[model samples]
Each structure stands twice: as structure tokens, then as C-alpha cells.
Target: MACYRVVLIPVDENWTPASPDDVPPQPPQPNERLLETEDFFSAVREAIQFNQQTWSERKGRWAVVCEVGCPGKTWPGLRICTPLRYKIASIWWPPGWEPNSPLDMPLCICRTHGTLQEDQLSYEQALATIQALNQQAMDRASTMWYVMLAVENEPVSRTISYDPAGLQTTVEIRRLHVAQPAGGGHGDCSHCPARSLDCSMVAPA
Candidate 1:
């Protein structure tokens, strides 16, 4: 099974990162309506389930552990940021789980020591890179080049036919291309002398 760490925990504004010497947080009070608490399993679960909206809203900010060959998450890359599935009863995990351990809860289950930021920074970088490449192709050859973003020589992001900013969404996995004419099966790749394919994804600075 993959290891998980708690990334988003609903806490008070004044809450500070817990230290080893500090006492563990107490159960939610009768009036703290943020996360509606059931019989507590772990401190993290209490934060996740106590409120209906607190965790639901945070689902948008989910993160993933960066794979070795995989482009680090955050950029406007193709890999979809999916919400992890979890059952409340499963929160009562076996021994060895600590406060900072990867949470197995239903928001994000990180496999790495931690997770990349959920802000889709990688996608933004990828978009910017492709826009530059598109401009280069237009200027160099006066033709539109399909810019493909790659990581470890593999194209993990979408194959863009034109400008990246015109895209409706970034997590596109399939090759977004134009419909080929009869008897011409993606002939542009073989026929277009000005065509080029390149990766725009780069590690965060």
C-alpha cells in the first residue's frame, strides 16, 4: 500500500505547527461547527469530517507525491488532480501512524514523503513554455507547430495544436488535434516541414 500524509487539516487561524513537546489537540468542542466530528479516530480525521464544507472545499487544493520520472505536480500539466476516496471507519489505522503521517483520508493520499502544492503551478509554466514555442514555430516557419510537453522523454501532458492559453482545461490527456481529411491519417506530422514537437514542462524554480 502507498504511504499517505495529511496535507490539509482544518484548524483554527491561530493554530501553529505542532511540535514534539506540545500536547496533542483535544476533540472538537460542542460548538466548533467547522468540521462536524463523529467518534474520533485520528486527529486528522476529526479535521476532515467535522464540517461538511471545510473538507469539501479543500478538495480543490489536493496535491500528489512527485514520481521520479514524473514531472512534479503543480505546473499546468496533464495529469488530473483527483480527489482521494476514503471511508471514515478506515481512519482508525493500525499502529505506527503519527500526526504528520500521510493521511489515508479522502482528500489526497500522497505517496511521497510529502505532496506538491495544489495550485497547478506546473500547468502555468507548461502553458507559458508552449506559447513561446508556438511563437517560435510561427516565426521560424510561418506554420503552427503542435507543442507536446514531456517528462523523462515521455509526453505526459496534452499535445497542443496551437496556443496553450486557448485551452478550456489543462488536465487534458488525449492529443487535441484537428480532424484529418479522408485518405490523410494525421499526414501533417509527416508532411509539414515546419512542424515540431517539444516538452514545455520544467521543474519549479
Candidate 2:
């Protein structure tokens, strides 16, 4: 089986006013990046197929697990899942009535059914969970989360139909390194950028 490293970018919820007249800011959307180790495509395809089969008959709540590390020390990451329940109400129909019309039936059903189970935690909570998992992985193996980008290949001419040259695939990944916070403080910048006025600068006058 191939190996792949997935990195998910947490959505930023904290918003500040861009201008006095502007409306309150909204949270940014979460971005997901997947990195493959030489055989990412095959591994990801297998993972998805396995998950789909597991989800079909699995009862109660569901969680997605990602295996990390080699045989000596392997860790399984968890993500809580919740089933989607849709409720469609109409004024003309009775309460809790099902849509008989084919047009309305499609709309009544939620589209995001087979997707991964979603967590109730906020953006910050999700980020914290990911960070903790990454730290655990780092402690076990020297590997860190890396974002996968598009692949590049050499050009091939159509005139030479069976030519075996000029065909190459290059996978790009943005590596993220884990390091100790500056000053060993709480990672938050509460006292950063110290003002000179607060410093002991005696006036010449």
C-alpha cells in the first residue's frame, strides 16, 4: 500500500473590522491538502474505497482514522462523525410531511451524506486537535504535515505516437516544520512589541 500525509488548514474565526463602516467579518473556509509519499494516488484511492465500504453498514456515530508511522510505532488519528438529518417543511402540507413531488424530493434530501463525519467543535478546537495529533506524530517519527500541490510533467509530442521519452511526473508538497515557540511563552503575543515609553529611557532634558 502507498503512503500519504494529509494536512488540513483550519478556518480562521477571529475577525476584526476592516473599516468603521464595513460589516463584521466572516470566518474563512477550511482548506484541505493531501501529500503523497511517492505513491500517494494509490494510497488515497484505497483509503477512500475502504472508508466508503466501512461507512455503508457502520452503525451509530462514525469516525475517520489515519494511520501514521511505520510498524515499530504506529498511531491512529481520530475524527468524530455525525449523520446528516434533513427536515423539509411546507406551509401547504401537514407538519412533518414528506414531499410527494419528485421535484421537491431531491431538494429535501441533504447532499453531504457520505462525507466524513463532522465535529461540533469550533475552528480553534479543530486546529488544536490537529496540532496535538501532529505533535504526537512528530514525537514518534521525524515526519511533519506537508501540503500537496499539483504535479508537473515533461511535454510529449503527438507526432511521435509511441515515443517513450518526455513523460515525467513531479509531485510538489509544502513542508511544515514544528518548532518551539519564541521566548518559550504561551505562543500568544500578549506582551510582544514592547513600547519604548514603557522602557527606562531617561530624557536628556
Residue 139 C-alpha lDDT in model 2: 53
Instruction: Give per-residue CA lDDT, model 1, range 35-64, as digits (tens).
Output: 212211222233333222433464422222
Q: Compute the lDDT of residue 188 as modeled in candidate 1.
A: 19
- TM-score quality measure for candidate 2: 0.17
Worst 10-residue lDDT window, candidate 2: 146-155
Tens digit per residue, CA lDDT, model 2, 29-147: 21343333434333334323332432234221112112234221112231111111112111121123232211221111212222121323322333344345434543564222211
Query: What ranges in model 2 sit over 4 Å off?
Result: 1-38, 54-205
Worst 10 residues of 1 by lDDT: 175-184
Top of the candidates by TM-score: 1
Against the true structure, whose lDDT is highest? 1
Q: How accurate locally, in lDDT, is each candidate?
A: 0.26, 0.25
